[model samples]
Target: MTTVADAVGWDGALDALAERIAPRFCRPEARRRAGQYLAGLLAPVERKNGWQLAEVAGDANPDGVQDFLARMRWDAEAVRDDLRGYVVEHLGDSQAVLVLDETGFVKKGTRSVGVQRQYSGTAGRIENCQIGVFLGYAGRLGHALIDRALYLPQAWAGDEERRRAAWVPEAVAFATKPKLGLAMLERALDAGVPCAWVAADSVYGADSVLRQALVRRRIGYVLAVTSGQRLFPGTVSDWVEDVPADGWHRLSAGDGSKGPRLYDWAHLPFRGAPEEWGKGLLIRRRLADGDLTFYFNFAPAGTALKELVRVAGTRWTIESGFELAKGEVGLDQYEVRSWTGWHRHITLAMLALAFLTVVRTAAIGGKGPGRLGRRTSALDRAGDPSPAPPAARPSDPKTRHRYCLVALAKTSPAAGAALSLETPHPNR
Candidate 1:
């Protein structure tokens, strides 16, 4: 079998990424282990646990690989800084959105850090899992996770023994998912990761504090809210369900697999006095079932409905990032049991996914790295040769990456097996 070293050297993109992240580690051995870990992640290993990764890296002792993740002195945040820089360099856009969402990693035991019975969107039910809140940067070129935080339940946070066993920092405290999302947003903004809007699902959107925090930063957002969310149109609070039938308008948020994700949309102007900023309620009524979803939007005055809809649509980009990262880079396939180890593995996996996204974009002839503008449709980037219309490929970026990976494997037999892991077991 072709070795992992040969596979790493076979791809210029992988090599460049390795060099990019090498400086984060002070010790040469640390750097070497980091490279080996990344190579194993990018390798199409069936199970990306420490032992499998160590075996692939040609290490006699798997404990060394575990040590790299568990005890390495490198700063994972510095690597995150590098990741944000790299992503902005390639996919940054003024109109790009910084998206927030959380994914669940199912675990077997209570010993694993932050593991508890929780609602996992990945499993579509309550499961024993650890939750990870992630922020993704999405632009015309593509999207990739820029930062992440592991969510600790209140039980885990209050138990000192459990916390110590997990190596939770002394300063770390119990924080809700939205708070974690806000902290990540602040970090991205502090690093000057350019983005025009912030988007998230109702979990974060329903938090009035999170919304106010965004307003304080002068950052615009289109965040989903529950139907019961109250809004004021003229000093009178009104439930989103109170809107009249005539208030709704047919609009397409963005294109999807079948066609446009058409829905009945309506906007209610806020009652507040005219100011530099604007607040409003944007509602989407499903065409098929009339199931309504509400969004709380904050933007500059005169912002068009299409733009608000566009921002709301961008929420899926983070979901796409999650799916691809888990499927291709083993985002949740770690054996680590501590807080630091989880961050180490996740950050490295994110780096691998970012590299693959960049490669996939370049391979599919995506637009040159440039300024962000109006949203770019996926059809514009797909360099499909078949006579079928671009819509045939669906606007999903993950599909594009899969196709590119398959093509790359065909051209390079040495890296084929390592690049062709089975398709992600359907979401759960």
Candidate 2:
């Protein structure tokens, strides 16, 4: 019997995601059915991978199913975009931040898409893996991953021999993580999401291309910086008169305006800077918690340091995002292997995470996830059970889907921050 549940079906969420993967890639109904089928087929303890995921998602013959998935134009980015659209629509024009970070997926064998022996944040050591540079956003309504680019390895770029053997596309070139990050910021901007800023760790913050691109695009950014990084504004006169870099620049810190925070400027042109770069105020904030430093080339001098700190702090959302995504959800498990399969699985896992984030935002408020200080009686070896139903997806075509992440934020951590989502028919 063909059955669609009367209440919510986790797979049912896919039915609304037309903004993402074209229906032709995998019929939403079929994909949902395949996913549900797989969910039931896998043992409770089974890993999350395509081999197992395909068992139920597969057709009468397993090989044909494998071939079909590989051949499809679909990739995890498509689903991630779907989840992004859903959450953004729900948010409805509140200020939000998109965070960029690279995650490593460990692979023992050769031939996983973009896998190489490299530094993996997940493993905290050098290992064979594919590094994924991703962009995520969260605000009053919810949070979701928006875009992804596989870190095509330098090996593929340097070796024509391996390039030919691996069929690495000719366009692939040696790009540092920051370069990939710049492209992602551009992608978010191009999508026209209502973003106030971009955030990331020192890896991206230190890269000149990333900071320059954000400045060139006039997109604001906050990123952690290595203590050694230098920043300063272009030469300008004092508040009283136009002056050059040989002048003094200082900023007062704290409520009393007497805090130790201060910076001195060395005015310079965009010339000595990195490519496509503009020169601006550089702030060096030293504190006991840790030393923080960065440069803001585009913002006005009066606001430069504040903007830098705000942008730099935005990285926490993704850091908290990772904490919830990995610990609360089973993101670390590798129950699948195909390039297509791994992404597909991660996409679904992200969907669930997005769903919960929305719930927490709507029902309560989701600023960012916070630790409870100890394991809660609320959590267990069994994964967070599904959360209660959310208000219907918002009706505005501009923003209606991402109740998925609300599911994650709502279920376990309980959205420690304020959720700005409006209730459905509050009058009733």
Candidate 3:
């Protein structure tokens, strides 16, 4: 089972990454602290806040680290662009998916930028928190968060005193969450990040302006839509209500912690469309509770239902990315309250996550340890959904490993070894 991960000289990878992004830091001290900050993020620290991260970075106190985050001269946006380019260069595929989603950062105080008593997905309820809209890149190689925007509610955006206190820029105005996601998508597309489909939850999907923008760009999407979304003449719920039981097809949206996320799916195409471009509605019914979800799909003509389902499943990839970034790289552990500090810390955390993904990809040669019975179902072809028996779950003994190079680098110092630590499935 020894792969490139075992043999490839990965000791210099982080150093090489630091060198690659060195120019982003204007001063030598900033450049040096940047390396330390990234390393601290990668280090096995209990909490990745200023003091703990500083301790991991061998600093006597948190003052330097805090200053680095609060007043660092480096441009977080420029670093974000570098992160986008790096992820694309390593994990890029023309068939890759660009996923948009948001995660909540639970904050106790009102001082944090964009913090409000809003619905926090992280908390699973309405809580005082800041929402960060993120863009994730998912290819056959791997997935990583590449771009991020802090959601600024109108309350914060319009308040001049709070804006001054938080250093919110004058140019930054109130934009909806979907608008933020669209802007990130536009940035990635304009930079030629190379993605085939965009997958997202209904927040973005419900926005006709965003959907129209994607359609105008000729980009495909499998966006979750609310039940009330208009289609042709009748609403989505009305149209899907009449779909015969025989019309439903069983498919896996993607792999989950247990196994394939199997569900019954049905597709209903829009009546009018260009011959080249296909438009449709995709429906998913949970086998356990019969709960339903809907997706508005757009793609080239003759695209298989399997492909659409695959894109639909890709939306979950960003969720996994969020979990990994937050769990592994302090994505949600920042103590910063100001606008600049928030972006800087998040950008660095994202960079750390990207570094891990890239290293893991290189080590494993872009393949999971074992395949979980990848038999193509009989229903994969013919381009429609129907009901079928679920496939038997295979016994996959090996768990997916989270690779950390920092500990290895610490031990080997010269030639970094790979530390393959067992972790729950990324899809969990």
Candidate 4:
């Protein structure tokens, strides 16, 4: 059995990445500690807080590690710039998708920077948490978080005393989540990080400024919007109801854990764009319940429906990337409170994740994973052991073929078992 460490030069890869960003740190001690800090994040430490990280780094106390985060002289943005270059060098794609989203970090007490009562998707409800807007790159090679901004709520941004205590810079001001996302997107574009499409949920889609900016850039997008949002003439839900049966196409919006994310997809094109640009409302219906979802799409004329579906599907890559980073690289395990501390820790963790992404990409022969380090297989298409027909099977060829494969597996257990053994289950 080949372990991940054996397949990728794990230590050497980390060392090379550490060396690549070494110039970001001023003092030799800060440079050395930064490397150690990154290693600690990549290590199998349970909590990944400062104390635990220090113990893993063989330091007597947490002072050195804590100082490295709080009082370090290095600029987090400089290291972030290097991180972007590293990702683009290894995973760049001209048709790549730049995904913008936010994740919440649950925190206690009143003093933690940006911590307040808010709705956290991580918690599934309203709670005291901090939100961080992040930009991710999904390409032919793989996906990883490339840039991040800690979202400061209106309360914290206005409270002068809290801002002083938390070391929030004077230039920092209240910016909505969409604004933060737009800033990060602009940074990625200015750096020439290759991408053809942008994907986001309704939070950013509702921002006309962001959408118009993408339009001016000549970049394409598949941005989700609320069903109630107006689409020039009527609500999006109204438009969805007007689509006839023949307009719908059953397609696989890329593969998921179970198999292809089979959905009923259709779009209503908008007129008045230049000859080169196409605009429309893309709709997706659930096969199980016929529930509807909507997206605002902007692409070059003659772009295939399947191509838009592919761009829409790429949105999941950032979600899976977040899970991998939090699960495998301790992306949200930091215990920092100050503005500087948060950025420093997050940047180091992202670097660790980028290293893993590059190594896994190489191991998988540059055939990108459905999620980072994990690829979908024929076994995924082999549904249940008993091969019962789904309640609502679409007439699409891909959907029909999936059922056939399931039936074949049931009829030939030996062949199915052989196929299962030939393809390794992904390591969590």
Of candidate 2, the 10-residue stretch with the lowest lDDT total is 400-409
**3 in model 1: Cα distance from truth in Å?**
22
- Across 29-57, the per-residue lDDT of candidate 2 in tens digits comes to 54554344234232343544445544555
How many clashes in each structure? 1, 43, 5, 0
lDDT (Cα) of model 1: 0.75
Predicted structure 2, TM vs. truth: 0.61
Candidate 1 lDDT by residue in tens digits, 158-249: 98888877778767899999999999999999878888899999899989899888888889999987766644332112444445444455
lDDT of 3 by residue, 162-195 (tens): 8877878777899999999999999999988999
Candidate with more favorable, higher lDDT: 2 or 3: 3
Candidate 4 lDDT tens digits, 381-417 = 2331322221221223221011000000111211112
lDDT of 1 at 73: 74
* Stretches > 4 Å off in candidate 2: 1-46, 51-68, 73-80, 92-94, 158-170, 230-308, 327-345, 365-428
**Backbone clashes counted, model 1:** 1
Order by TM-score, highest first: 4, 3, 1, 2
Task: Write down the TM-score of every candidate.
Answer: 0.80, 0.61, 0.83, 0.84
Residue pairs clashing in model 3 are 5-363, 248-386, 248-387, 249-385, 249-386
The predictions' CA RMSDs to the true structure, in order, are 16.6, 16.1, 17.9, 16.2
